[model samples]
Target: MSYETYAELKQLVLPHLQPIGTNYREAISGEQKLVLTLRCLATGSSFASMTVPFHMSNTSIARHVLATCEVLWKVLQPTEMPIPNEDKWKSLAKRFGDLWDYPFAIGSLDGKHVALVNPMNSESLFYNYKGYPSIVLLALSDADSCFTLVDCGQYGRVSDAGVFQASRISQLLDQERLIIPDESFMVSTTEKRIPFQVVGDEAFPLKKNLMKPYAARTLDTIKRIYNYRHCRARRPVECTFGILAKKFEIFQRPMRLQPDRAITVTNACTILHNFIRRRDGHMIDRTSEINYEIRPNNEQGLMNLRPQQGGRNSDEATEIRDLIAAFFNDPRGSVMWQDQNVFRNVLLLED
Candidate 1:
């Protein structure tokens, strides 16, 4: 986290985080408590690990961290993830097109596994495919790498699509009550048009308003180009996770707290991550992140749980993806250097 961000967060939560008594022997000062919490978050250290340096017992350290996190979550979640008006959706689309070369994209969708110990008596509930106990932190981030929506604390055993199907955000999108704009944008200077949409990897199901890349190892030129553009558009969410783990460090190591406490810690860090990105525009480039790989296609089969919808929705989704792919090849819809850049990179890889 940036120094300015740390200072701002500390200033906002300090008063609420303070103990009531004026007596030093009775309780620690707000400044000391805040410092202790920040240290744990920055280093992902256990409470017992912090006892020697902070001179506080492990119990006190845990208390301070959880209490501070609760206060921050209540104060910041509303402002950071407020429902978007029509103008806000349009603004997001404009930013996506201008910055990411993907027109009509509202945000990038992805999930990260935050490692933790297995919960007691829960048989394989939190165990992910990678043979680890964890929780999934799913988020939709805009072009600036700020989280527009976050749904954390889902079972790590579930795939990204399953997590989304179970999330309240999916309910909102399904009901068309998410305050999305109704306006359509031109995908081509001609008659081709599309509604603003979110882009994700093939882990997510395709919908009229949500896009995923074509799922195949063998791809034609246009499909590969479309996949390239779609992947680039989805990079921000991955970068957001990278930046969060890099700054908080807790995500780099398995969490030792109870499941509930682990949720609180992850939630607090998420809000703080957005706050810093909104305040300082800090985004880590993640092009070279070796651990970041697409989730296996077999793992993301989550449509059975979704509500039965009319076939028109599926048809429209295919039509939308086709229009976008055609738009990517059109002179008016295409970026001048996009084809050359993609081709050059492909050649470099082949060598």
Candidate 2:
């Protein structure tokens, strides 16, 4: 964004802010604090580089940016939380399938590694799958590119699956509230125990809701389109990661701060990202990312009990499948798009 955009955001946030004192209690003037934050997020520059333009020390810049983030997350939007309850999710599902013309109507999941200067007790968690030191940030975003859920501070070495299972989302799933639709499921090793699956790449194990694309050689247009459409919807999460990496170059560079600081900064960038997106009236770019190759997994997964022997007895499978199919089938119907949109969201979330 340009200077005007940052200035506009500063204007919006300033009124909500608690005034800075005369002394540099947090290492800079109030104006400089906001300026440093804008530079960090809008330009994606490092603290050291940002310090030159503001004429402040790098440590001071980092402190201001972090403190400002605290204010944004805690004060400006005390009620803001990533997890959406059923009613809100149903509403989003409608927009996903209708306004966005995307498929599966579920939030996309992905992990981003924020590089950090190795800290103490980092031996186990900071290692990323890429064979480097980092912290893992797991995010789930909708087709609109807004984050519905965000998880940070896991060590880079932790697998996406591991981070997810240990997250608050996992707790939600355990309560049987995070309903996964049929198309979201993949062929599981064993099943009946935990029926809902989390959609992810092949690196993720096959469970009821976890889905993957068929091989390129075997996929037909419908399957291909389905996969493409699902991916199209999911790109927001990846795009958000890009924006964070691109704008806050610090996220891309290794960090020297504590783990808590890294987590706060990541959340701060997200809150700021939403701020910019809300102003612009959009969340994601239109460019398409089309790679569909599946990754190979070497570790064997533990087996869960399979679906009950009684076929046709489970309505869960049927209901979810229909929900997924509606994305592609309902748009062109003569009954009108809005009606279908309403009917579909109500059906999916009511149960």
Backbone atom clashes (below 3 Å) for every candidate = 0, 15
Clashes of 1: 0
The C-alpha TM-scores of every prediction are: 0.87, 0.67
lDDT of 2 by residue, 137-235 (tens): 877776666666777888778777788777766566555566433222222222221222334553443333544443457654344444454455566
lDDT of 1 by residue, 138-223 (tens): 88898888888888889989998899989877888888887777666553333544667889888888897889998778577788
Candidate 2 structure lDDT = 0.57
Poorest 10 consecutive residues by lDDT, candidate 2: 288-297
- Per-prediction CA RMSD (Å): 7.8, 11.6
Mark the regions of model 2 whose C-alpha exceeds 4 Å error after superposition: 1-8, 15-28, 50-52, 76-82, 99-104, 176-198, 205-210, 214-226, 281-351
Whole-model lDDT values for every prediction: 0.79, 0.57
Superposition TM-score, candidate 1 onto the true structure = 0.87
